[model samples]
Structure formats: structure tokens, C-alpha cells
Target chain A: MNLKVENVSYRLGKKVLLDNVSLSLQERERVAIIGPNGSGKSTLLRLICGLNKPTQGEVLLAGRCVHRYPRRRLAQSLAFVQQKANTEDIVRAEEAVSLGRTPWIKPFEAWSEYHQGFVEKALLQVDMQDKRHQYWHTLSGGEQQRLHIARALAQNTPFIVMDEPTNHLDIKQQLGVLSLIHHIERTMLVAVHDLNHAMRFDRVIVLKDGGVVAQGAPETLITEALIKEVFEVESRVIKSMGFASNVQLIA
Target chain B: MLVKGLQGVMKSHPLLFVLVSTLTLSVFIVLGVAIGETQIDFQTVVYAVANGALGTQYPINAIDQGVVWNYRLTRTLVAACCGSALAITGLVLQSLLRNALADPYLLGISAGASTGAVLVTIAGIGAGALSMSFGALIGAILAFMFVVALAALASGRRMGNISTQVILAGIAGSQLFNALTAFVIAKSANAEQARGIMFWLLGNLSGARWQEVAMAVPVLLFGLMIVLWHSRALDAFLFGSDAAASIGIAVKRVQVVLIFSTAMMTAVMVSMVGAIGFVGLVIPHAARFLFGSSHLVLVPACAVIGAVFLIVCDIGSRTVIPGQVLPIGVVTALIGAPCFALVLIRGQRK
Candidate 1:
């Protein structure tokens, strides 16, 4: 199902965090929401996933308001990987990943092999199968991020939303994660700070001051003028052969 | 050797794991009934149980039967229920609040219950109309509400560090209620009344009749059911409430229902058995250590371990001084304090 965020605005006290922001994601499409700090990128994602109710307008999934759906049902359709979201450091990685199956499991039901298969597959996808028994605190920040992604994968939703998923990852791990994202057929809405990473997405939506400044195919939308206007930085969009355009920042 | 064997069972057969745990709990309960001022053999203890449960004559001595069936059995059963209830409450609180130090009493329930009990015993608030348990329950609920309100107030302005804010509010509320309890006793109680209240406050199971069992069992079962039903949601909270919500959990509703239900269960336990500390704080950690952090395993494991641990503590309380019985709370604290310190030290090392 396609995900829709329609004219959504979120306010905390007198400060408007998200201002009438609207966006949509087609099924199996990968989109990146890129913005400068304090541009309401995270807030927009939260609203879309029904983590926060929009003060104005509504988020619709498959023609129904997102918040109107039952939490478990909504969860089965959309999984979320949050930025800096952590639990008790003592939880084992495998146990943490298996929790993604919460929406599907019923009371008194045993954990079936089917659920275990998903968990194992997710772990393998993130190359975290070896560290599945490790305590969360024992893992590095990058490892933790991968485990978080594995959890969302194990959820096996049609749509997966993420906030700064590649934040703590190294260059190689970042590319690896992006590659994994590319291979996954699920619809993805990722909030990314790295313009280069945003360029790699199928489409990019640039947010500036809580509203979308530009959104389209990255080739057309992510240009020097858009970057200078939205990010207030001088950058050259270097087109490459059979690859996503790389953003080279002017020093 | 036994621990390893049990682990093997737990890994391979879940039904066997439950049966073994139940058997372990029964053995501890039987031991609790057998060892006391007057030593009763295991056979007599079993006979007393059979008579009580199966309505068999059993040909047991009258005094032995009376002591075993009426007094020791009820006390041990009540202790088991109280232990499991507190442990489950602690586990829930730790998960939902995302604080390692979170316990059943952290939200001021125990302190409030003590104040309520003191009010009834000293100030004559109900004037013989209300029982101490009822008063304690009232005080507990009121204290929990106060903590909730304080937490809400603190969280209203900023959406940052809610778990820490709630923990701070809990500390503040506990201090306030504890002070109130102290103030009431100092202001109103005479020498004998003060001593009686003190004894009760330190935890006494002398009053654990069948009625207490009837009260505690259902509450424990209900609370366990509520927790078990939402075990998946609890597991989802591994990464905090926001993460739980993103995964389709009704975070607010789940949090409210869980905290409220666990708090109520904790209050009931405290009202029945005073503030038996440590079991709530320690058992869940031990369970998590033995079994991983899955609530599916941890909940039942904590319940069983907590129940057995309390029964052992009760036995220690009964037999430690030879002729005199120590307060179960004092015994638990004595044992619990060291174990708690060990938990802290181990946590630091890890």
C-alpha cells in the first residue's frame, strides 16, 4: 500500500516543528527525506508513522487515516527504525530482533519456526547473525544500528520508515547498509542528513524550515542551487557513470 | 548440577520447564511448612496438604495438622503470592519505565501504604470501620497518583528524558510519603502502639490466614495474566516507548494499564505483608540474567524464582533465632541487601 502524509503540521507549545508538510511514497519505492538540522525531518517521519498525531491534516495509509487503524494492524503494515532509540543495554541482539514479531504474535501463542526464520533472515541480511547472542551494550554503535535495521526487517512490513539509520555507521558500513536498502523490495522512507546518501535514494525530498523545498527524482531535484538554497552550502553535484550522483561540497 | 539440568530442560521442553519450576516451588513451600518452632516432618507436611486439598482424613496429629495446615501453609502460600506479585511488578516497571532501579515500591506505593496503615493504627482515621489493609491500599493508590501527577507535570514542558523524570518523581513521592508515615507515628502513637505498628511495618506474616490467600492468589493471577497477555508489548519496549509505538504498540494505553495494574498488585501485596523489599528489586534481574531479556521466558522465570526465594526467606525468618521469629522483611533485607550490592557490582563490571 502507498503511504500518504497530507498537509500535516505538528506543533509543540508555540513552536511549530512541522508546518503543513505533505509527502507520499509508492509501494516498493525508496524515498529519502533530507533536511538541515531543525528542519522537522524527524518530526515529519514521526507523524507519517503515527508516532505523533498531526495538529492539522492527516496521514493516510491505503485510503484510511493512519491514526484510525489499530496499532497492531498499522504496525503489521509499517515498521520503524528510530534514531538513537535504545533499550536496556542488557537485551540480547537476537531477543531484540525477535521483538519485531510483536504485532503478529497472539497471547499464549508459542514462538513458531516461521517467526524464527524471519529473525534469522533479518540477522543474516544485516550480517549480524554472528553477534545475535551478544548483549546490546556490548555491541558498537554501528552494530546497534544494524541490529535496529534487522529488527525492522524481521517485522516484515510493506513499508519501513527510518530516521538517520546510517548516522553512526562508517563509510563502508554506510555503503553496505545502502546496498542492503537497495536490495530490499519493501517501501522505504528514510530521513537522511547526508546529501550524498539522499542522492542515492530513488527519490529525494528536501526539507527547509519545516516545509518541502524540492522533491523529485534526485537527478532533477538535488542540484547545486537546491543544495545552496536548502542547505545553505556550496556543493557540486558530480554525475557519474551508472551510479547515483555524488555531492562534492566546496571547501 | 541441578541448575545445569534445569537449563537443559528449559531449552528442550517448555512444559517440562514449567513442571520442574512448579515442583521446585512446591518443595520450598513444603520445607517452609516443615521447619519452624515445632519441627514437623515432610510426611506430615504432605499429609496436611493432602487433607487440606483432597479432603482426606490422613490421621495426622491435631496440633501438628493445625500448625501445618492453618498457620505455616497459609503463610508460605501468601509469601509465594506476594513474592511473585512484587517480582512481576518490578519487571513491568523496569521495562515500561526503562530504569534499572525501578521497583514495585519506586513509585511511592510502599511508603504510602505504610502511612495508611499507620493512620489506621495510630490516628484512628477509620475509627474501627476500615481495616489496615484497606487503609494501606487507599494510601498506596493515592501515592501512586501523586507520583503520576508529578511525573506528568515534569514531562509536560519538555519531551526529553521521560524515564529519568518519572524516576525522579518517584523518588520525591516516596520521600514525601515516607516522611508522612514517620510524622504520623511520631505524633500519635504511644509506646505499645508504636511497637506494634513497627513490627507490622517491618513485615509480619502471622496474620496470613486463608482469607489473605484468597485475596492474594486472585490478584497475583490477574496481574500475571495482564502481564503475560502484553508480554510482546513489554518486549517491544526494549528500545523505549517511542520505539514500541513505532512498532504498532498502543504505548500510552499499554503504559497506563500496565503501570496501574502492577501498582495496584504491589499495593495489595504490601498491605498484606508490609513493605517486603528486595524481592521485587532483585528477582527480575536474576531472572533476566538466567534467561535472556525476553518477557516470554523472563516473566514466568521471575515469578518462580521470586516465589521460591521468598519462601526460603520466610523459612529463614522462622528458624534463624531458634525461639524468636524475625520479620520476613528484615530477613529479606539482610539477604537482599548483599545480593542487591552484588547485582550492582556485577552490573558495573559488565
Candidate 2:
């Protein structure tokens, strides 16, 4: 499904958090939203997931306004994995992953075989199938992050939106999860603080002061001039062997 | 082999766990009805039960019939209902607010009910036999509405509410109603009347009758069924409201229905058995170990475990005094605190 954000804005009290942000994303497209801290990446993701309303303008999924569909219908087509998604209770790993089937399962019914298969496949994808019975609080932070992604995958939606998807992850876990995310074959809109990770996306949308500063294929848009202007950081773009650009931030 | 088999069965079928717990409760219930001031024998009690089942076809003597059928039967059954109602209500509130300390009385409904009871007992608004119950129900609903309205106000621009803010508002609401109750007790009543009010506030179940039991049982069962129907939604809610909504659960609508149902059940239980404490606060946590916080399993576990807990406590209240009946609330707190300490110790050891 195609997602179109049409000049949407959101205000919190006296402060405007999203200012006329608009974008059109194609099916199976991998787009990255990157910016400094508090640059409205999380807010925009919230609006896209229908968890928050736009102060003005609109969001359309498959050319229909997103607000028109009920929340369940919207969830069937899309899933959102939030940054710092946490539960303080002692939930088993498999139980947490199975929660993604909630939109499909009825209140009185148990999880069907197909739903169970989804949970199994999701855990397999994240390589956490062996630890499915472990309690969530007992898992390492990186393992928990991987489990959270598996939960999002278990939703079985065509599109997945993530905010700071690799937070609390070690480098190996980060690379592994990102590799898994790349091959999951879903339309993805991921917000990240890592400029290097953003550079690997098909498109990078750089945000500053609650508006899009630049957006395009990373090779074309992520210039040293643009980095200094948007990030307020002095940096050199290193040409790496397999990466589009390796950003080395400098003081 | 036997222990493993038992464990497997318990794990696979949650209903079997509920069945076993209910069997335990049934034993306590029998004891509750049989052992009174006069200490009726078990066979005699069984005969009375069978006679009642047969509509008194083989009638027992009138005095024994009155003791078993009228007094012990209603009060014991009512105590069980109170246990089931308050425990489930606490479980709902605890899950809804994501707070271990949240109980059925957190919404000020008990304090509201107390204020209403005070008005009837002292001011003579409706001085009939059942007016106290009626006034208490009205007060419970009113307090529920005020807490919800206040939560809505404090929740601010966020679509998903903050449970802590709602809880804080509830405490404020509770204090308001409690002060009103205290003022009425101080000014409008004599010393003897004040003493009775204190006993009522501390939850005495001596006035429980068949009429109150008839009203409470159906409401508790129906309310529990509705909660069971939405068990999956509540399980999703165990994480957080945002996570629940992300799974396409109607977070606000479900919260509203759950709050009202719990309040209604609490009102009915309180009208029959004053403001019984600790059963709601502690039983759900004890049941959580058996069922592991999934509402489908947890609800039934709470129902059975809470029933057994209350019936045992009621028996203690009766037997501790030779002829005098003890307040159910005092017994619940006095027994509950040490048990709660043990639960804490066990939890930490785990």
C-alpha cells in the first residue's frame, strides 16, 4: 500500500512539533527519517500510525484518508514499533510476540494455527526462537530489542513503521536486526538518529526544526554542506566499500 | 510421573486450574455454613442442604432450618460473592492502571458509598430497611462519574490517558467524600450511633440477608462474564494503553466499560457487606502466580481464590468469638497483612 502524508502539522501547547510535513512513500520502499534529538521524528511517526491527529492537513493510505478507516482496519494494513517500547511485567518472550496477532484474533477465541505460525516465523526471523520461553525482563537489552521487532513482524502487516528501531542494541545485534529488517520485504518508514544507518536507505528525509530540510536518494541529498546545515555538526562523508556514505562526525 | 502429568494438565487447560480451585472453595463454603455459634454437625448441614434442594420435602426442625437456611446460608454465600466481586474488580483496576497497588476502592466508590450510608443511617433520608443499600449505589455511581470526569480533564491533549493522573484525581475524590462522611458522623449522630457507623465503615456483614445475596450474585456473574468476554483486550492492556491501541484494541471504550462494571459490582458488594478491605487489594496478586496475569486465566483464579479466602476469614470471624460475630473487614486486614508480608517475601525469593 502507498502512504501519503499531506502537509500535516501538530502542535503541543504553545509549541508546534510538526510543521506542514508531507511525503509520499511507495510500496516496499525503505525510507529513513533522520534528525537531531527532538526534531519531531517521533511525532510524525505517531501521526502516521493514527495514534495522534494532525493539527492541520491529512494522511492518506492507499489514496483514502487514514482517519476514515477504523483503527483495526488500519492496523491490519500497518504496524508501528515504538522507540523505548517497554512492559515492566514478567511476560514470556513467545507471549509478547504472540500479542501481534491481537488484531486478527477475537476476544473469546484462542490463537489459530496460522496465527501461531506467524509468531513462530517472526521469532525465527529475529533468531530468538531458541529463547522463546525466557521471561522478557530476564533478556538482555539487545535481545529484548530483537524480540520487539519480532513482535512487529508477527503483526503480518504490509507496512511497518519504527521509531529508533535499533536503540539499546549492540553493534552485532544492530547489524543483524537491520539486515533482517532489510529482507523482511515490507514497506518501511524508520526514524533513526544514526546518520550512517540513514545513508543506507533508498531515501533519506532529513528533518530540522519540525520540517523537512532535505529528502532524496541518500547519495544525492546527504552532502557535507547539508549535514552541517541540518545537524549543526562538522562532518566528512567517507566513501566506504559497501555503504552509500560513511559519515564521520567531528568536533 | 504423577506430578508432571498434573503440571501438564494444569498448564494446557486453564479451566482445570479454575475447577480445582473452586473445589477448594466449596469445602470452605460448606464449613462456613456449618460451623456457627451452636456448631451444627456436617451431616445435619448436608441434610439441611438436601432438604432445601428438595424444597423442604423431608423437613428438618424449624430452629435448625432457620439457623442453617436463613442466617448461615445467606451470609456465607454473600461473603463468597463479595470476595469474587471485589477481587475481579481489583484485577481490572490493577491491569487498567498498570499499578500493583490499585484496588476497587481506588476510585472513591467505597468512600462515596460510606457517605451515602451515613446520610441514611443518621440524617434519615430513607430510613427503611433497604434504603442504605439504595443510597450507597447512587453514591458509588456519582463518585465514579466524578473521577472519570476529573481524569478526562487532567489527561490533557493526549488521546491515551495517564493512569497515575486518574489515580491521583481518585484519591482527591475519596478524601472529599470521606470528609463528608466523617462530618455527618461527628455532628448528626449520638455516641452509640457513631459506634455503629464506625463498625459499618469497617465492614460488618451481620446484616446480610437473602434479598441482598439474590441481588449481588447475578450482578457479579454477569459483570464477570462481560470481563471474560473482553479478556483478550485486557491482556493487551497489561503492557500499556499505547501498546493495547497499537493492537487495534479500542482502549478508551474498553476502559470505560471496565471501570463502570467494576464500580457497579463494588457498589452491590458494599451495600450487602459494608466496605470490606484487603480482599480486593491482595487476592488478585495471590491468584496472579497461578494464572500468570492473563485475564482469561487470572479472572477465574481470582474468583475461586478470593472466595476461599473470604469464606475462611468469615469462619475465623465467627469462631474467634464464642457468641459474638467479628467485623469481616477487621479480620481481613488483621489476617491479610501477615499473609501479604509472606507473599512479598516469597516474591522476592523468586
Candidate 3:
């Protein structure tokens, strides 16, 4: 699925959060939004996911206005995995993942076989097949994030939006989550804080004060001058093995 | 593997356990009619109930018939219905709000009913025996609507943040209603009227009648069906709003429907039998502990356990003092408080 943000802007009370931000993601594109704190990175993702409406412009998914689509229909096309992990009840991981099939279920009907298959496949994708029976409260932070990702995957949507997907993860789990995203066939738009992690994306979008400052292939846009201007840091971008771009912050 | 394990556990206890429990409760319900100050014999009670229902050729005294058939039997059935209704309402609300502490009374139904009953008493508006129950019903429904409206306003018509606000509003509403009730009772010139008001406030099934049962049974059944139909949505809500909404569940609509229906049931039950406490609050937790949190098991189990608990409490109320018929509400609190404390302690240990 292709996502097009056409001149989107948002304001909260007296503060303008996003200003004329327009971008697009083609099919199977892995894109990262990188910026300093309060640069509207998370807000941009929320707008794209239709959780918050833009003040001035609109978001289009496959050439249809997202706001005009029914909520269930929109949900069927795009899934969002939020940053929060605290749940009020003790639910099994499988039960949580099965919720991804809500758009396909009718009132008073049992879950169908296709929904079950999707949940199973999604769990297996995250390597959480063994933990399907475990309580969500018993899992580690990284495991819970992975479980949430699996739930998003189970939605069977071609597009996935994540906000700060690596917030509380350690270095190894961080790499694991990014690697899983890299291997998935779906189009992904992730808001990330780490430049090195953002370097692994097919495209990088640098934002400043809610406007798109630069966007293109990661190697072309993640320059030392861009880092100093957008992130207030002196950095070097190096070419590494496995077609990976590595970043080292200069002191 | 876990599914098979759960199935095995359920199979081991099938309908046989429910049948045994139901049989024991029926015996207790029948035995409850035999007690009371009249000292009616077991045979007389049985003959009275059968003759009352079937017009059998059994010789039964008029006074015994009035006490057993007209009074004790109706009260017992009302107690059972009220208990079942409140427990089911609590289960639905708890699941809807995703809060274990959510109960029918916690949403201001009891307070509203109490306020309505007190207003009717003070104004002498149709001060007949049945008017008090009617007034309570109106008050409960009004209070329920007020709390819902307040919660909706606070949450921007969203269901996720309404639970805590609804509870707080209920507390405020209860206090306001209690103060009004107290003011009315203070101004009463007749000491007998004061005593009647006190008894009603404390809650009793002593004045139970066939008319009350006629009103309660249908509401209970309707409420049961509504809760059961929304059971899957309730399960989704337990995972949280985003999770539920992500799954295509309309969380707000389900919350509104469940709250209003449960409140309607609560109002009718409270008006008929006064404000019986603790059954709604405690029975769902007990049901969850016995059967897991799955609504398929928890909801029906809550109804059964709630009915049995109140029946046993009603029996205790009659037999414990011999001559004096204790208020069923007081008995339930006395019995339920200690058990609730035990559960709390156990939960902490866990």
C-alpha cells in the first residue's frame, strides 16, 4: 500500500505541533522519521494512522482519503502498534494477538479459521510461538514489544505504523526488532530516535519543527551536515558490511 | 495443550455439579419458608406452597397461608432474583469498564433508588405499601442516567476513561442522596414512620409480595440475555480500549449499552427489595476464582453463586434469632465482609 501525506498540519491549543508536512511511502518501502525531541515525529505518525486528524491537509491511503473511510475498513488496511505496554488485565499473548482479527469478525460470531491462521503465522513471525500461552505480565519488556508487533502483523494489513518502536529495548532486542521489520514484506513507517538504527532504513526523513527538512535514500540524506543541523550532533556516516550504514557521533 | 487441559477440568465437573448445587439451594429456599416467628411446620409450609400454586385439596390455615405463601415465598424468590440480577450486572459492568471494582451500586443505582424512595416517603405521594418501591425504581433509573451523562461529558463521549469518573460520581451521588434521606427522616412526626424508613434504608425482604416478583423476573431475564450477548466484547475490553478497537469492537457503544441495561436491572431489583449490598461486589470475584475469568463460565457461575449466597443468608436471617427476622442485607454484609477480606488477603499473597 502507498501512503501519501498531502500538506498535513496540526495544532494543539496554542502550540502548532506540525506544519505543512508532506511525504509519501511507496509499496514495500521501509522509511524512518528521525528528529530531536518535540519535532513532531510521533505526531506525524499519529496523523498518518488516523488517530489524530491533520489541521490543514489530509492523508491518503491508496488514493482514498483516510478520514472518509470507515474506521474498520481503514483498520483493515493499516495497523498501528503504540508505545505503551501496560494493560489492566492478565491476558495471554495469543488472546492479545487474536484481537488483530477484530475487523473481520461479525457481532456474536466466533473467530474463524482464517483469523486463527493469521494469529498463528504472526506469532511465528516474531518467534513468539512458544510464548503464546504465557501471560502478558510475565514477559520481559522486549518480549512484550515483540508480542505487540506480532499483534500488528496479525492484522493482515499491508501497511504498519509504529511510534518509537525501540523505546525501552536493549541493544540486542533493538537489533532484533529492527531486523524483523527489515525482513517483513509490509510497508513500514517508524518514528525512531537513534540515528544509527534509522540508518538501516531504505529511506530516511529528517524533520525539524514539524516540517520535512530532508528525505531520500539513507546514505544520501544522513550526512554529517544534516546531523549537525537537525540533531545538533557532529557525526560520521560509515559504510559497513551487509549493506548497512553505521553512524559514529563525534565528540 | 492448555485448551485440552481446560476442557478436561470442565468435563470432570459438568452439569452434575450445578445440579447438586441447585438441589441444595432449592432445599434451602424451601426451608427458609418454614422458619420465621409463626413457627409453621415443614409439612404445613409444603402444603401451603403446593395449594397456593395448584389449588390442591390440602387443609391449610389462612394465617399460615398468608405468612408462608404470600410473604415468605415471595420474599425468598425476590431475594434470589435480586441477587442474581445484581451479580450479573456487576459482572457486565466490571468487564465493560475493565475494572474489577465496578459494581451496579458503584455506579449510583442504589443511591438513586434510595433517594427516590425517601422523596416519596417525605412527600406522602401515594404512601401506600407499593409506592415506596415505585419511588425507589424511579430514583435508581434517574441516578443511573445522571452518572452516565456525567461520565460521558468527562470522557468526551469516549468509554476508556469513564470508569474512574463514574465511580467517583456514584460516591458523590450516594452521599447527596443519603443526606436528603436523613433530612426527611429527621423531620418525620410519626415514630413508626421513622422506624419504617430506617428498615427500608437498611434493606429487608419482609414486605415482599407477588406483585414485586411479577416486576423483577422479566427484568432479570432480559438483563441476563443482554450481558451474555456482549460477553465477547467484554472479553475484548479486558485487553484495553485500543486493543478492543483495533479488533473492530465498538468499545464505547458496548460500554453504554451494558451500563444502561445493568443500571435498569439494578433499579428494578433495588426498588422491589430495597438496597441489598455486597452480593454484586463479591460474587463476581468468587466466580472468577472458582471458574476462570472467561465470561462463558464467569457470568453463569456468578448468577448461581449469587442466588445461593443470598438464599443461605436469608435462611440465616430467619433462623439465627428465632423470633426476630433479621434484615437480609445486614446478614449478607456480615457474611460477605469476612469472605471478601479473606480474598483480598489471598490476592495480596499471590
DockQ values of all predictions: 0.73, 0.68, 0.40
Error of 1 at A226 (Å): 1.9
lDDT, candidate 1, A125-168, per-residue tens = 99998998777889988888888889899999999998988887
| True contact recovery of candidate 1 | 0.80
- Which residue pairs show backbone clashes in model 2? none
For DockQ, candidate 2 versus 3, the one ahead is 2
Model 3 CAPRI quality = acceptable
**What C-alpha lDDT do the candidate models reach, one value each?**
0.87, 0.84, 0.80
- Model 2: DockQ against the native? 0.68
Q: Which scores better on lDDT, 2 or 3? A: 2
TM-score of chain B of 1: 0.93
Write candidate 3's Cα lDDT for A99-144 as tens digits. 7776766555655677789999999999999999887788888888
> Considering only the true interface residues, what is the Cα RMSD of candidate 2 after superposition?
1.3
User: Where does the lowest 10-residue lDDT sum fall in candidate 1 chain A?
Assistant: A84-93
Per-residue lDDT tens digits of candidate 2, residues B142-225?
887888788889988785766887799899999999999999888889999999888888887788778978998899899899
Docking class of 2: medium
* DockQ agreement of candidate 3 with the native complex: 0.40
Model 2 root mean square deviation, Cα atoms: 2.2
